[model samples]
Target: MMKKLFSLSCLPLVLVLLSGFMGLQLAEARLHYNYHPKMLFVFGDSYVDTGNTRIDQPGSWKQPYGITFPGKPAGRFSNGRVLTDYIAKYLGLKSPLPYKFRKLIPQQLKYGMNFAYGGTGVFDTSSKNPNMTIQIDFLNQLIKENVYTTSDLYNSVAHVSVAGNDYNFYLSRNGSIEGFPSFIGSVVNQTAINLVRIQKLGVRKIVVGGLQPLGCLPGNTASSSFQKCNSTFNDLVLLHNNLLNQAVTKLNRQSKDNSTFVVVDLYDSFMSVLNHPSTNNIKEPFKPCCVGVGREYNCGSVENNVNKYTVCESPTSAFFWDLLHPSQAGWHAVYNKLQTTNAFQQIRY
Candidate 1:
């Protein structure tokens, strides 16, 4: 009887070990995608921001923000790495250093820099920082100052993550819903200029993102009890994505390298993960695993100098970390979808 019991215990252990090994193998296989980039230079907003926000901003110097990362808040908006980190890892490169921090560590400039700032848009949003045009202008200045030589620009990869900060600003200022289409047009027009500007700045390859399902974000879904997505907002997101696709197509056509400008389809990826959570092993696809109790707080927010937000036991099971941002697991799922598509593939040189 004792011998039989020991055999059963050993069997379970063996199976568990085998399963873990198999999972590691699968992850390794996925990492083997035929893609590589010399350097990844990122711009735009919080989604791809690797700590470019000013110190005064709530996200840059907050707690619970980096609890899962380097054990302290390192300026990333999410619990851990964001979309850009995963994308850089996928391309076999380290997450590029933020432009703000780059000045402090000049050696990091060789790996490329992240010029993305949270809450800023192609045009100015609420953030009191450089807009997209000014962000590019900063890079232009860096080049003129010889911070990055022409060779670095020619061999580097550029990524822009202009989420809908402009939309949020419009909504906050009570911009009429009737003006939505025109606003979107202006956003895309400026985005196109930014893309062209980066290419002209000597960056060889570029990738821009289509907006995610803003309506399904934890913030938007909160009013609906997280049971239903706001389709109206999703419709607006689709319109924006459609315009972005057209712009990328046109930009590629006019570029000298004859290389395509890629669009990271965050919209489709978010929808896919939300609609098919089972496939991604996500238990809460819309509801944030971390949330504040009342309207006066948010993920990582503190009330009365205490942690107002409650964190789920397992962040990997949750799709959202906060109202506007995704959990690290959520970004992992989206990155998986992006890897399966040719968009990310085409950007690899």
Candidate 2:
């Protein structure tokens, strides 16, 4: 886990002063804010994980995971594309190859690599997978090997998704709710450090995802019969996003390129879609399209060769794919929401 480096109150005063001078401004020329990014580098958990967790993540490689996209199971946690693929689409590039599979397809190296593994967080989780720090170490190793020179990263953008794995891991360990705000502070503080490290390595820009409404996740909402969200948990998510936004803003000011660090407010984007499900043609915004037959099972769970999970008739009609991830269509809807946010404009031409 990322060390609880400092409190959220430490959000530098200098960033607040520079915010007006550096952030995207309508008065600035269009060309100044737009660039043709050649590649994408990804970090964090399943939300942005394309296919990096195959070995440790058996469930994702099982049937019904990639059925929505490749017509069969792949390493993607969703039935189809998740946040990574949609971000690639928005940038007009193919989803970056998985770091685990980079050796098999060296030709695709130009596009970039995904270091994210499912079930991982900025810190180590129960999965024992590489945390965000280790993920960056992989990139550092490649750079040292001269596989990716500074030029390769100069025209590239990075996407970091913090999809609440850390918090989930915390809860699973029986961490108290009263201590969550302190932990959230550490997550955002470490995230800022990660952004700075990536920028220093030559990535032109870094887009960090904010925490979504944890109260609305299927895992949390299952108790409410999918009828409503738990406001208490969601309020904590707001705290996370607030601190994350502050960190990103400060990171932008400290970057070599002004506004190099940007944030995609997943909280607002998710809440908007959930609040108006029909606007995105979602019939069940709170429930998942894929679910376990019993609490012990999950989306792709199997026992004695018999399927232990159920899939909805139409995934597109549902907002969630499993308890923790979104369906492909769900991600597309979220991506559309990003287009309308100022933070999204930094990475999109």
Candidate 3:
């Protein structure tokens, strides 16, 4: 009887050990199981903007903007969802409500909030929208009002998309080509400061987007007949990305905790899809799905009930939806490539 009792106790211990071993195996198979974030905070420009721009904004509130997804214009810069939507989906959460729409839908506040504004950047751009610093102030106000508890921030991830609007603004204002490197350094430095600020604000994970290949955008490729990317522009983008990577690395090392920052390599992701279009099912990789009828117009331009922009028959076949933004299909393809990297994994837990 004594021997039997001892064996029974041993059985429970053995079972516990076996179960733990199985759990370890499962974790190895799926690394993200333990790192689920309760909410996502979005910042920066149009690449991640989802309905934050005003209804009067010509870029988003017009036809052919959200045509692919919502079947009408819904303030998304893309024809469908943008990068934020896909990233939210990957994390098993609904896309967070835009800051402008948060009060309108109080129930959706649990998912988090998006402070990104289209055509805005780290500094004041020509768009006259809130800069990134001011966007964070909006979050700070919410925190002060107890809209988000400390626990909410601790379980949240911040996604920052500073995708070259500052550069565009600089160049448009006749910024010297020779001084471009210094300008890029300043941009990256300020971005690093922003990332650190977000971390200090209680976000456990922060993902800063690397600049995409600026030369590959349809706007830049127009001179090349949308046939080839300008190597010079892409080289400048590489310098920006390199500086960003180094900054992130240093930030991680300085942290007393685990890795607090990650970079979404938009440059490599864009180049991969554009260079090997067939693999991504993109037929016209360089050409945009939407284009203006004239130089003064753009996608979604309409005057007197007459549309000035024309759209391709199949938006899914084209990599670019317009001059600067990606089509729904284009973003989906890029998201697939992003998953293959450790960008998502770093943010997990």
Candidate 4:
């Protein structure tokens, strides 16, 4: 009976009911009214990245990554779009250009700039990519060069994604599980600081994504044969999101006039689709569609002129794209669910 209650296949009745309520309340509580932004500024990790990482490296730049959307690799970690593209679409704007492409397409900067790099976190991780703070520093430098005018900042929305790389880094360094909660607090606190710093830089609205269900990610779920989410890991995720929500609420009260802070509840959005994939036309929720040929190789690995990974016949039917990221269709499903909730209310346009 206890096992049945925790089974993700049926999606425990308690969680099924909570997802709906949390979506509505979290959005409404954090949003500000009657504001429309003409541009967007993105920061943080891969979930919102549209290819800021180095092309020479083996990542989004490799083949089969962007096959679904661009007919080839275009640097998005997914087989196509990601959260940033979907959010930009919702705002009726083209997806923002990556900071790396700013020199190549100077005129397109008005749409916005993406400073997010895959594998980065609020703190430094195994990836040498710039951390969230450094990403914002790049924006600040651009703003000083007058590349972005006061009007641009005033009319823009900032989207921040801090996924879970910090925790991954912590564990890799052998951070004890008993000490994890306190570490979670530090992550949330630093995240709140990042949000406030972005707000201070003159963005009218800022939306920081709450951490997704880490236990349900393919890297973790693989242990359960993709059949169950580790309840222990998920409990800590809830703690992270709850603390983030509180931090956002406090920022809304303390921020400048019209500088709104909202926490986008990606957790609920992802969980809703994972729990009910048929609703979104997805077949497998936890199992990734692309994987390495062996334990050491990853979705994009290649060796000695040979491909070291296998991609699905149709990526659109899969929820997860690789061990760590979602497929383009997976993001689309999450976005569709997001629209039903009140989360985007702050973006009036």
Candidate 5:
């Protein structure tokens, strides 16, 4: 019989009691449950990234990034943890170590590894970071070396997050708005290919994040005084999400037995939080907790100790931590809503 994990009701108390410690022991204890995964493989961009980007990259490795979590810069692209941290928590597992740090701590390998790099996408972006294909190649190489046995993979789940960096690159490169649908198709198709490759490499289940409402990001909402989302951008985002959903459904149908692909509806979950801020306890749905002092600067901008970015009085009340990413509170709310849906169940044994 499968042992039951810690109940959700105990989370608040556990956090409070373990405030002094790193608190991973509670997560490990919770994983004693039967259906829980033994490992979690992460790929793709900043949304699920936990310090995979290089130290030379100022975007993630600088100050104000991990201010809300580890209380210092920790290479996460948010004021605290991103979606990856929440997902790991949900699975009763410690957040996976980044691929860049895998060799430094061999003991952490049992929880799996993260190949996500901030500012990366399915294809190469302006950041010149490793693309999704290369990220998977890292895993493949490790598997080839017998770092993870077939059984380890059979008991694991893979999470993929490709959060709009490709579209940003496409638009910035003067790609026509009219060709957006075709571009989305290409992205989803390549994502499907990556998913299949992971399965073939031995992963049992894969969770792919659908695009969030791009219009609702602080970068888009700034012009509207953070009061409303740009409908045109949101419409384009909807097209991407719809296509992605179809692709995931097709992948599941083509799978040998049970559904192997799951789509986390980031669109709906983001829209829900933004549309019903009161329900989610978000005081400012579109306003970012961090912003630039001028158009030339952005979150975490600091030059010679002259700070160009300002942090909000309370990051916990704001939905966006920066122009593009969600605050820790924002991700927590979205994760709560996700638990109420069937998406997460697709990965369970």
Candidate 6:
């Protein structure tokens, strides 16, 4: 009877092991099933820009910027791949080719096109190029020209990264804080219009990103010795995010699938990683890894060959890359937080 009981126990163990194996197989199948989006169309500014800027453009065509990437300035604004590259990798696709270089790299045409430009916004920008509306118009013109088919759009994902250039433009023009809300209204209205245009163009899943914490960017925090975030600027970001949330809900109702639109919360993700610094290896959580010697200089280049900037010995140990962008490591950490949220995960399908 003791031996019989032992055999029965062993039988249950064998059944349990078999069930675990089957569960693993089912999960793998689900991952593959959900990873079906074949293309990625990008819009907005530098956060998602994969080298859409001109070779003469100071932002992309510089050394030290891509020094960590392909050992050269490969058009990304960081030491390596930016947020959009990782998002494409997560979706099982290659980084979409820059819309500017689509003619040069025709093979990348298959993955989809990137319409984002560094330093540009929904409205006219300090950068001398088409704005967000013009970027979308380019894609629409491509569709009219038959560069991409409806099937491609239906099976694709789109990323829009409007990381507060509109507000920057407002401030640059000396627009008062009292007028900020109206400016935000204009930004969100145009953004919503852009979302609808992409959906109408037949794209199935669109992810519009929330602005990262502007107050935490080294540009805004430098005055505080990088010790504190400017809460005033952050407040405006919150307002933008609230409006974006409403816009996404409205667009989903209008699209073919209830899943037509999503928001990638860069604000919370940046704050989460900053609030809870990675337990291992990062040396500076808030300070930029790469920065110039003075306010007038930038991360990638020097003025009159004076070598005006400095880069940390290890880029991965820092969060901000320069005054405005995140390091490759910084983006990786933020991506981790983003993946934890359901908003981004649902876009995988």
TM-scores of all candidate predictions against the true structure: 0.87, 0.89, 0.91, 0.88, 0.89, 0.88
Worst 10 residues of 6 by lDDT: 276-285
Per-residue C-alpha lDDT of model 1 across residues 102-206, encoded as one tens digit per residue: 768887777788988888899888557778888898899989999888888887899999889999988888855678988899999999999998988988888
Q: Per-residue alpha-carbon lDDT of model 3 for 123-182, expressed as tens digits?
A: 889455799999999999999999998999999999999999999989988755678999
Please report, in order, the local distance difference test score of every candidate based on alpha carbons: 0.84, 0.86, 0.91, 0.88, 0.87, 0.86
Q: Count the backbone clashes (under 3 Å) in each candidate.
A: 0, 1, 1, 0, 0, 0
Query: After TM-score superposition, what is the CA distance of residue 278 in candidate 5 from its true location, in Å?
Result: 2.1
Off by over 4 Å in 3: 1-32
Question: Model 5: how far is 62 from its true place, Å?
Answer: 1.3
2 versus 4: better TM-score goes to: 2
Candidate 2 ranges beyond 4 A from true positions = 1-34, 55-58
* Cα shift from native, residue 295, model 4 (Å): 0.5
lDDT of 4 by residue, 144-232 (tens): 99999889998899999989999998888985567899999999999999988987898888888989999999999998899888888
lDDT of 1: 0.84
Alpha-carbon lDDT of model 6: 0.86
Which candidate gets the maximum TM-score versus the true structure? Answer: 3
User: Mind sharing the TM-score for model 5?
Assistant: 0.89
Number of the predicted model whose lDDT against the real structure is largest = 3
What local lDDT does model 3 show for residue 42?
99
Kindly indicate the candidate among 2 and 3 with the higher TM-score.
3
Pairs with backbone N, CA or C atoms under 3 Å apart (clashes), candidate 2: 1-123
Candidate 6 lDDT tens digits, 1-349: 9999999989989999999999999999898666679899999898888888877777656878887787788888888889999999888899999998889989989999999989899889855767888999999999999999999998899999898888887887886677898889889999999888888889989899998899999888888889889999999999999999988898788766887899989999999888877653456777888787766777766777667778898887788788889888888888888888999898887
Candidate 6, residue 127: lDDT? 56
For model 2, residues 149-263, the per-residue Cα lDDT tens digits are 8888988999998988888888878766868889999988988888889888888889999898989999889998988998999999999989988887777677666778888
